[model samples]
Target: MSLSLCVITKNEEKNLSRCIESAKNIVDEIIIVDTGSTDRTVEIAESYGARIFYYPWNDNFSDAKNFAFCQAKGSWILTMDADEALSSVDKYKILPLLDNEDIDIYLFHTLSYMGSSPGVDTASNLNIRLMRNHKGYQYKGAIHEQICNVNQQLIDKRKVKIEDIIVYHYGYLDKAVAEKNKAGRNMKILERLLREDPEDNFHLFNMGNEYLRLREFEKALEYYRRAYRKFMPGLAHSPKLLLKLVMTLEALQMYEEELEVLERGLSCYPKFVDLEYLRACLFHKQKKYTLAIKGFKRCLTMEASPLHLRNINEVEGYRSYYALGEIHSELGDHEEAYDYYLQAIKAKPNFYMPLYRIAENLLKRGRNMDETKAALEKFFGKNLNAGAYGKLGDIFFSIGRYDSAYEYFLSAYEQMEPNPNIYYNLGMCQLYLKHYQEAYQWFEKIEGGRCCEDAVYRMALCEILSNHIENAERFIQLTPDHAYNKRSLVYKAFKNLAVGNPCGMLSDDKEESNAYVPIIFTLLNDLLKISAPEIFEKSLQLLNLIENDEVLLKLAKLYYCHGYYRLAYQEFVRSIQLFNKIDREGLRLMENIMDLSTGFTI
Candidate 1:
């Protein structure tokens, strides 16, 4: 039997060619129905020798798709979206499935990519893409369309499942969604449908899903609750509705409510690993480690089934392992944590969190940096490219191991083309090491956007630290007027100090101060380490302007931890003067130190 590939389009110039090219060799004819074409969609269709039909834009997907299906002339019909393509493995394997006369329809696994890159964070579902032509099958619904029979009812065909048949869909990706304005269009259509039938749970559930994707949690929760109240257990989307509701509640931090819904969902779908995974996550959040561990272990016992339309496959493997690792780490079972983290890495090599944890633990234990690098390199096998090296550098940078980070960044830079992020990372490492001129040169290489702005600021600060006051002022003046530039607390404090008047640099804006004070403190401390005693003394005057006792107390502890006894003592005295009873334990420690000093009394 010959097959006709049917697709409906509207200005799908970017995606139409891919869709047609993927199935052209397997199908007898390509039938394209264009609702509207403000671009080269129709031209491209003609170039592919497709039998093209024109239909007016009526804002109804089912109607447009049904029109396309009716025009198919082959014995069998295969329908697909403009943004979807048949997988190479399944392209040549379809005709055999059609040889079975008992099957009226074929359900293919549809993998919807959620990000720019393929095979990363995909949502999978089963979809009816193939059916006998002239079987009176047509699509229904205006927005999230479904298949129906001649009687305009949901189709109840003899269906065959072919797990090997796969379709890759890219319309849901963030960039694609934004370019198509899909969310706005879908919300409009769904809202119109909801107004006509306010209590329609299917539409309500879809509305919740749309809002959830848009990250409007409160609105998503509202629609999800409405759908849950209706709770049509027999419907295909009912289980998904409950899952989405729990996820919405989780996003909103309504954990108690999420647990209630999860328990209800688990009652209905006892083996749904996603629900169990979420339950474990909630338990982990609440520090109920025993329950969380049991739940996560239960998840690992089940395999992820594609029958669950929204099954996140990782929940049954790496995600659970990672969660277990986090729990073990929290409980201080470092050895157990390390084992689970390694298992997680083994499950998904590109998953970097486990690698991060392992590296952090090794560094914290004072393990040799070279040995740690060797351990991490084993995960990449023989394919440790420049990008992988950059990722390693990023992980070390995140954990404040700038020396190790610099080494990796240098390795990445040597092997790769020019990259602004690598330059910025290198600059930051040098800046932290008090190599101002080297940092300035690295920062100078960055050219555009927010990273450029930050690099410029750092360059100015580097010049200031190197005593090139004129060059520093010139660099500062070149920056745009933003909080990180002139208005920043660091800039304001430094400017005041440069002018020999550091007393009034602190602003009365507590929120602004809270956000920027630590940055200023770190900068001043770094300057002090480089033997800038004059700037260090001026920074003390700036600190005196900050009247927050908590800030002063934290600074004292930080200073004491770094072995700056005189600075720590000064901060402790100031902290005590600000709050009479705070940090008493710290005070007792100081007194003990003083008593020991008396052994050298002259």
Candidate 2:
């Protein structure tokens, strides 16, 4: 008289027995309606003494489930699936709910396990699994079927509570999900539902979920947007649909649109921390650090509440610390960043990214080099993904530690899945270190990929700088042989200066503008070292045609670096005349550099 567990089965032979076994003590009666099982599913159910009835194979899940519901003699009905089981903790919490006559429905939280090297528990979803049988409650829809209680007014939080009754779901594991082909099957049914009532946002939202599962983000966005527009105007719109739609927008990198959606939904669903967390990420990506900080901080203030019907993938505890740490680190707040990164490590000891970043932040601060080395040692052993290692390399590279950067990048290349970008970075570090021949070898290792053009261009620079003029020209010819862009042009000019010729004619104004000071300041400094009188003469002549303040300022720095204090002083004097045209920041930078370069000629 207490609880009747209702289940619908197909060829669930492998799963039915375990599911029934787990439910034996939880429910008084087991009512299973089989839709055609060729396996030992029925035999296993019989061993559990489940009252089984046959319904000819109908693709309609709700039909079969409703048939089982009708046969349940208990006062309350509990709908369950063959792939799910009640958690031990939840089993105890649920028993007390059955005796409460005032409660008409109960929402059970379902936790799915994602199949990977080590299975991960996904987010929680509240399902109407338990309700009074006298309320005329039955199932609806074919796929992702739901309970439609006739006494819907009693579904408020006061009468219906979401208990901590966890249902562990294995339907999303790699083998199970693929074997079931959930997305493919659901899409077919959802399309039919859409065709019948084209404007029905319910079907549209479901279609979006199927495509989202399959990673067809553009299609998902199309349907999610259509559904959002249809349902958003009314007070009865589903919070889950809006949240899922926002996720689709994020997958598409439509951050601006996602921000808009989040703002619209947050007012309606303020308690949803998942939305707040995503809003924080979106803000961080867009570099709105202040707003992002606020959003992340808000997540810490929320109590544990129900997330939407999608995968419960949001980090439950202090996971936002990792993101907050990244934002602080970018804003140059090392103290705050270091603290958050440590907190993140505490929250998830196995998480590799924060460990890697902690090393980077410590190294940047230069105060805790020993700790930085230790963190890197731990990270190197725990992670094989190239991104974390590559990022560490980038941090070193930015701080003028060429040898260290090259070593990290090479380590990344050695263990990573043969990505050409890592190869490109190795070549780039050697180029910065002025090991031209060594740089060429790294670039030569990659034969093809999206980074090929960039690698070839750098390789050509190496060849030209190493005095292999013919090889340089050959490498350049092998490339996309269009007009020289900024990088290629600067390197080509250096080649001309090296070969006792003038920096050749540029392709266009765009190419000329592209040769920024940072790209070739080192090349220019090297060219000034050439003892040949003609080379220095041509270099001076090259500067005559380019009279920008940046060039003049960089020339001053070059002169200072090589002890031409008088030449540097003269250049700085000339640069100051054009300082009015620059921004305030640029003006201050020029003055600071001029002061540092000022000295008597040696």
Candidate 3:
């Protein structure tokens, strides 16, 4: 039994050498099929002692691949793409398998690396990459092409064995460029095929995939839904079709529709981890944290490798832990949430999500500025992207460090295009620092985007703060659905006072004057009602102006309620600083009282 390595190429000069080098020692002969190369790809193939054959660019990969297979002289044909290479272990396994005369077609696993994320190098799948060179074997389709109709051929010949070897695919090396090229070529072929066979479900599915690759998701959904509708009941249902439909629905943010499709698929195939994971994502997006946690937990219970689990720490099933952390955080169980987040970080050291959440919780507590800043700095070090910088700005702003917050917010905004939230934050920070003109400019940039309502309100506030009363009134009149409408009215009263309208100032009743805290508390209370009530109540009381000593007493209760045993234990450390400030203020007041009394005695 002899083995020959076969590959199809088209201007694969950058990748051909690596592909051939990996297979050089394992195979007996090398056959290369070039479908028009203007580069040194063919020359490089010849350098590696490969028999080069030329074929016209027929707009079909399977045709070119089959042609290469037909030309191979060896009994066993091992096929690979120009961007794929056999691992050393796989190389060793292939050498033994080739020598074994019992095998007809050897199925090897291909691990495709779509992007560079730690602990997630590849997604694995099995393919008949190595096969016996008989006249009966051939390939099919144009895009996402496969060697099909082989089961009967194998059974007739009595030769088929699945190998445990792996091939690493670097085809997605530069995914954006590759997707563009692939989508263009595939769309042309699929369009022609659809014209010839208008009602073919398989072609429809492939066409849908081409559109998806092009990011025309709505078009993809149309084709996928057609395929699903045309699906035959007794015939082996298409897994790819169902998966693609689910994915299209997910991309559209049609969570309810996605759930319906998943439920239908699950009714047929009960234990599908992919569907479970997708459902979990949808629930999370809807802020249905408990259901999301349940779905992710169920997915973990299924038989899957660590690599197959998305955003999960495989060792201890930490996706659920992290989700629980988020839910707890939302609910106001800061201590339990923080512990889960810590566990998630411990399970997956490089994961930035858990760390960011923990930082957010600390900022909410208001006692750990130095520690929270340090944690954020470490997070930014690891994930130095726009989102991280934006988060840092949010943290600083929360603690009233407006200058530092503005610097970070500006860095995030200018480092990238002006995102609405970044501009919104930048505008608010500027308002606080009394840079009214600059604040208005930032708000102006957000006027046309999705953040328009918030932007308009902020702009109105900036005008009032700048004592531009008439302009402020005009801007406020321009938008009717401001979220902070009551706050805006109070600000308008203040602006009226600045412009000498004593009657306008007098109209500022308790409803308008004291609206900010209640509005915030209402929103927080609603969030708590959905998730964690105790923590929400704690956050409310902390920011409430009930009493000087009452707020301090509630902070300890908040920590205790959330199971932040460690943080609760250290509450006195925080109180000591507050106590010192209070004592100094008391002394100043006492001195003033004594001076007043001495004046009366004189």
Predicted model with the maximum TM-score: 1
lDDT of each: 0.81, 0.73, 0.68
lDDT of 3 at 563: 41
The TM-scores, one per candidate, come to 0.80, 0.59, 0.58
1-602: candidate 1 lDDT, tens digit per residue:
98999999888999998999999999999999998789999999999999999999788999898888889999899999999999987888898877887888887878898976665587777788898888888778998887777854655544545454789999988889889988888889999999999999889999989999999999999999998887867788887888889889988778789999999888888777788999999998776899999999998888774464445657889999999999998787878888999989888977888988998777666678888888877877787888888888888876667788889899999999888988998998888777899999999999965589778878877887787877876776776664454234566567567658534646566665665567667666666545567766666566555544467776776676555666666767777786753455577446644644554431
Cα TM-score of candidate 2? 0.59
Q: Which prediction has more favorable TM-score, 1 or 3? A: 1
Better of 1 and 2 by TM-score: 1
Candidate that beats the other on lDDT, 2 or 3, i.e. the better one: 2
lDDT of 2 by residue, 1-602 (tens): 48999988878887787777777797999998888888888898898888999998666778888888889899888888998888866676776788897787888778877764224446557777888887777778876676666656334556676676778777877778788898887888888877888978777888988888888999999888888776663433377787788888887777778889888777877776777888988888766789998988887777654534334454434568888899998788998998988887777766656765766677778846546655665645665466656876876766556677787788788777877788888887887787888889989988898888878877876776677988886776675633455555655665676687766444335445445445566556544443334545554544544434466766766776665666766766677776533333334444445555545331
List candidate 2 stretches off by more than 4 Å: 115-121, 149-159, 232-237, 305-316, 331-335, 348-353, 359-602
lDDT of 3 by residue, 1-602 (tens): 77889999988887899899999997889999999889999999999989999989888888898899889999889999898888876687786676667766777767766554214444555667887787357788876675664545434434666666778777654453464386777788889988999888888988898787667999999998888887653333365566678889888767788889878776765655666776777787676778887887686567653221222224235665677687788678898888888877776665657765776788777746677777667855765677767877876776567887898788787779757778888887877676889989989988566788767766765675566778888876677643346545544444454455542232224443344444333333323322444434443432432223323333443454444434433443355456432333233333333444543431
Clashing residue pairs in candidate 3, if any? 331-532, 332-535
Lowest-scoring 10 consecutive residues by lDDT in candidate 2? 580-589
- Candidate structures ordered by TM-score, highest first: 1, 2, 3
